[model samples]
Target: MKKKAIVLLGNKGKKYEYTRHNFGWLVGDLLSEKMDLFFRNEYTYSFAEKRIDEGFIYIVKPMTFMNLSGQPLKLFVKHKKIELENILVICDDVDLDFGRMKMRPFGGTGGHNGLASIVREVGTNQFPRLRLGIGRGKYGMVDHVLGTFSKPEKELLPSLLSKATDAIRDFFILDWQELMLKYNTKVSV
Candidate 1:
């Protein structure tokens, strides 16, 4: 099936709004604002919908904790009747440098509890994903992922967020492989 929906992996509470762990969620929020879509709580997620040339592209932020993100997603896909292959997950990756990103057609979660949960629930890791770089923290991995951005990172976020939003918009118009190739190596200014 063609990729048709987007699942942004992030925590939901206001406490997590600006935290590194919330990159994917923040992107979803930004995209919603830009597109004038308001997400409503439903079927275990904060969900919104938009119709492009092809069909409805869902914007979902799982209401569950990051580690259990899949619960909502599993419910979401069943509710929307969307196949796992037709969804794209956007998540933060501590493995890459800030401002850098990678897009993959399918892969392991690389220890991300959120991705792992989704994989287990969905019974596959073959779905598309966009991993936004947050860089490894000198403090600690756990601390890093939970912490808010630094001054420099905060300064750079607008540009990064813009690029990410654009990439997601492309998800509706381009094939997964083509979107991955176009975004994987491109660093945001």
Candidate 2:
């Protein structure tokens, strides 16, 4: 059976639970609940795995800080022997509007430190990624990415995450082209 991984990027700890940068962790929580999967703490990450048809899908959250996310991923991929193409990274994108997402087969980091680390550690930009929009707010870039969501954005978060998880589940079942065609859009929520 094939093995695939969904690498969710976010900082660990309760303090960051509701922050914009922790969006990937929030989505992972929702996806875990929907799939009835529980994460197990590893040395450098937390992960949950489930069998789907003839394959296994591993949902991973790197325990390292957001900027060092790729460190855990590099180790995990080496240990699991999972190919780069079979790993899908999910992360927040400050440039996009809230409720929007872009799914790409390969791309540059777009100034996201987490993605930059991944490209550096993994030695390539040729990996699938799902960029969730967190809309740059009035604050500076660092503050905005690390800040909490506004009232209205918090209200719409659930719907956006639901669509994101839907796309994640599809990643294991559908081809990359098909998943991109179906999920790359600005949701009007």
Candidate 3:
């Protein structure tokens, strides 16, 4: 089995927590808890790893913040000797409605700063990614992404995050194509 990396992208600090932009970290938090893993901090990021069967799953949270995620990610990949195909990035997307998600085996950044940094540093948009939607409401893109969840959204958030984590856990067991087919549809939560 190949060693795989799951990169959960988000900014650091309490100020960013619960904001729309921190969705990736939120998912990572839930995943860590579910897996009973603890992230060990490095200068650029924090990461937890678990060995399974003949492979390993590395969960990475970039502490370099969101925009500079690529620097730490690039270093991690090289250090772990993980192939690009084995890497999966998770992040928030503004295009899809809130609570909806989309996964791609490989694609462009789609205007995400963290993703763009990853693409630039990794030198390709050919890696797999799971995008959790944080839809743009009436507010400007900056405001909407930076703001915390609305009351209604907060009510529904736990289920959404749990589902996202489930999809992530599925990544290791199922083939990427099958996982996409199963998760890319309308997910009611």
Residue pairs with backbone atoms closer than 3 Å in model 1 (clashes): none
Q: Estimated TM-score per prediction?
A: 0.94, 0.96, 0.96
User: Least lDDT summed over 10 consecutive residues: which range in candidate 1?
Assistant: 1-10
TM-score of 2: 0.96
Model 3 misplaced regions, further than 4 Å = none
lDDT of each: 0.88, 0.91, 0.90
lDDT of 2 by residue, 30-119 (tens): 999998999998889999999978888899999999999889999998988899999999999988988999899899999999999999
Q: Which structure among the candidates has the greatest lDDT?
A: 2
Segments in model 2 whose C-alpha atoms lie over 4 Å from true places? none
Residue ranges of candidate 1 with Cα displaced over 4 Å:
1-3
Candidate 1: deviation at residue 93, Å? 0.4
